[model samples]
Target: MGRRGEHSKSEIECMALEAAEAIIEGEGFDALSARKVASAIGYTVGSLYFVFRNLDELIQRINGRTLDQLYAGLIEALSDCRHPQQCIYALGGGYLAFAARHPHRWRMIFEQQPRDDNLSIEIYQEKMDRLYELMEIQLKALAACPEEEVFIATRALWSGLQGVASMTIGRKPDREEEQWAQKLSRHLIGHYLAGLGTTQFNSRVNQSVGRLIDCPK
Candidate 1:
């Protein structure tokens, strides 16, 4: 264990977050506690309290970090794809891969709730919207629909991908499980995109017919 004043408050905060994530990644979230985190970082529990309000605050910070990491993974997944449709598949693949790789941390984002009132819903929404906006851009390019339709389509597609990850991704996912997730995600995206195209085509046809019907005969 190191001396108390060796690390600054900000340094201790970063150390605590990293140590907590390592504990969760190795032993799962149930094994995490302020004592364990402090011990790992060679700090006292009181020191941790100085940096974070409580365990709830620490967990919220961890969740925020996880969101940022997940967002980076999705952006990297978009790099190789050429078309918007391909980019969406890349996003799904990237999402599932990250979930499988960090199952405990990924699950913590959805499962853990911060009890403290200091948790800002706006901050949480901003992180979530960053992830959704990636898919929204792709859907807008592919469907060329109204804003409302793009919004709904983005969520619908992500809901399907989230379901695929939730159902298939395991604590220690293997090659077969990852492949299964990829397969299901592709199938869902393929069919959903096809339906979206058809709907847009029919809408356009209806509008054209409406214009002719209103024209002088």
Candidate 2:
């Protein structure tokens, strides 16, 4: 067993998060528990509680880190692209690549709902918004529309990419899955952007479309 003073409180928190991530990465979220993490980190279950309020909090912490890594990956993916359309394609491919590489951790960001709804909602929403904003920037450059319309376009394109990831990335990661996801994402983005450019969507058209469907802001 790990001695009480062998690791500082912050060190224990870091160790616990690392250990929990390993457990989730290897065996999936169902295999994660406070007892499992504590044992992996060579600490008693009580030590874990000292670091995290509960397993839900630990899960949220891990998901937060996963989202950070995802954001970094997307930033790298778009670094070399020149055009706005290219950047959007880079975003989609990068997203698919990240999901393919870390299917379990990536899936956990969306699949597992937090038991502590209030805390999770506030923290996770900010991270998700950052991801959406990356796409928003490119969509705004592509479509000369009001800020409200740009926001709607961003969500619409991203929703399609998310659907592609969900359908392509199955229970197990495979080389073929990544290739398939890439092809499907490029096809969808190509057609979607083509439609966006061809359509005569302005503030008036946007307001009319908004009246028909309940779209989130």
Candidate 3:
């Protein structure tokens, strides 16, 4: 963010981006506007237009900041874990805790889907991939499955975990929720990894019976 001997355009843009994120955190996206942002940072609305063409561009800046923070948290969580099991647990806990602390930021990351030009969906999915890569590497050490399957399963597991996390943040907080949240989330993550260790579901169903009424034999 430093340039030669003075403040660069990049530095100004970074300030605007951070300001926008703060605005979103203070009030929902509906409350976000060029004028509001400018007022918050003691800049005129025209100044914001210099860095961003419109509100959408500002939103993109917010998304980039969100991803940057998410990646940092993930790296820090996995920094000390030597075993894959510990790494996986840290990833899950870190993700949930992040959502809990920054509910608005979490939604800002996923609410509006990013454009698929230079930054394809794969780019966003890459974040999930990095997290799952740890699990897959560990799985390969003990399992005999194809890499593609592992990737797909890991994605599904993350989707499930993200679902619970986002829901917990969006829904009103409940004191009774304390009874099941930790156990439920942990069970979801454990089963996801444990699912990779096996291939059979051991379903006990009457195949002979169908979804039909017995009108006539």
Candidate 4:
């Protein structure tokens, strides 16, 4: 075990977070505890308290890191896709793959309710918005809809993907299950995009008809 002063405060904090993640990933979030994390890092529980205000803060930090990782995975999924629609599919595939790979961490992101501090809430919202922004960009490009429509579509598509994952992904999802989830995601995206295109087309036609009716004749 390392002495308390051997590692700087920041290093201790990083070590604790990594240890906590490993515990959660291996044994699930319910298995996480300060003492376990501390022991894993060759430090005392008091050492963890020194760097984190409480266990809640530590969990929040983990959630933040998970979000950043998820965002990066989604970005990587977009690399080979040139079209906006293709990018959206890639995003859905990436999301499901991440959830399947890190089932416990992914579940913790939604299931764990962090303490409601303003700073924490702000930070969480910013991280969530970054993910939503990825979908919004693709939706706007593909749908060519109003900003309000694009926003709604972004959330709607994500909600659908989340639902698909929740229903299909398991604690240790197999390749077959993962493939099934991907299939559902593609179906959902295909139909949703088709409906969006139809809606926009009908709205444009209605506006044109209204304009013609009101013109001087």
Candidate 5:
């Protein structure tokens, strides 16, 4: 048996989280257990409890990290786009690319809920709000609607994009799925923007419709 005090509690916690993430990424969350993580990190299952309250807490921690990474990826996707519409499209594409690349972890964020109400209230909401704000800013800039309308529009557009991702990015990557998702995203966003612009809002619809019409089959 290894000495208990060789690694600090913080070190043990970090090791446990890293090991657990690897397990989940490689073999879905159902396969993860405190015992497996402990064995991977050279610690006893009791050692894991010293850091996390239980497996539920551990899963929340992993989801939190995944959200952080996703936020970073979305930020990077916005770098090259100048127009608000372009930025919004970039955001959708970035979200899809991230989902496809990390399907398991991505699904975990939306599908798994933390058992701790406090943790859910504190961490999950904040990260999700940050993500919404990315799309919210673009919508606000693109449409001159009331704040209330902007809020509703953001939710509608994002929900549409989320639906596209959910329907297309299956557990296993299929090239056809990704392509169809990308097509649907651009098509939906283009038409939605066109409709919003038609309301004589302060936003210009731009060439989205033409682009959609010209899109390859």
Candidate 6:
């Protein structure tokens, strides 16, 4: 007989995540299903449902879990750097590395689209606020920049990360893409640090964010 698995519910959730990640890595999210996850972990589909009300909830949970991991890694990457510019730079590099290391999990977060007033949306907003707080701290440390400038620059910095991460996780980026991602990440951060080319940068980023929210809901 096969060996028994971990007994705790949380442990099963973790295992489920592991299975989900494998599915993502192998075939992308479009191919994911409870049966696949259940087969991966030797659990039945009913057993999986006992933990997740539906696939959306399971995906949301996975997104939340992976985002926290990404946040922790980025924080660790920036901890040793003193200058805010360096912190932001390290943040971009760490962000790319994390995405590469856990491509499917990273993609899920990048592609998530939660419905308004959903519990998962609330959770997502809370996490977003925390990330924004980190950006605020970094901005506060640099240039004595005004609140408006910081908001503009922060959006640029984050959107650039998202853009680069998406390329890396796409259908096999070429060598130029790999090299350009590094160059692009650094150049993008530098662009923001260089005053976003003007205070107007914030308004521009806001408009763009408002128009093109491809990153799920």
Clashing pairs in 6: 112-216, 113-216, 113-217
lDDT of 2 by residue, 100-182 (tens): 88888988988887877897886699899999999988877766667887888888888898899999997587999999999
lDDT of 4 at 200: 53
Q: lDDT of each prediction vs. the true structure? A: 0.86, 0.85, 0.63, 0.86, 0.83, 0.71
lDDT of 3 by residue, 120-169 (tens): 35346566456567556655543444666666666676787778776666
Q: Give the TM-score of candidate 3.
A: 0.75
Q: Kindly indicate the candidate among 3 and 4 with the higher lDDT.
A: 4
- Model 4 stretches with alpha carbons more than 4 Å out: 117-120, 203-217
Q: If both were scored by lDDT, which would come out higher, candidate 1 or candidate 3?
A: 1
Lowest summed lDDT over 10 consecutive residues: which window, candidate 1? 208-217
Candidates ranked by lDDT: 4, 1, 2, 5, 6, 3
The worst-scoring run of ten residues by lDDT in candidate 2 lies at: 208-217
lDDT of 6 by residue, 142-200 (tens): 64455776676677678878887786545444555556677888887886566433433
* Candidate 5 lDDT by residue in tens digits, 62-122: 9999999999999999999998899989998998888888888888988888877898877
The TM-score values for the models, in the order shown, are 0.91, 0.90, 0.75, 0.91, 0.88, 0.78
TM-score of 5: 0.88
Cα displacement (angstroms), candidate 2, residue 165, comes to: 0.9
Give the C-alpha lDDT of model 6.
Answer: 0.71
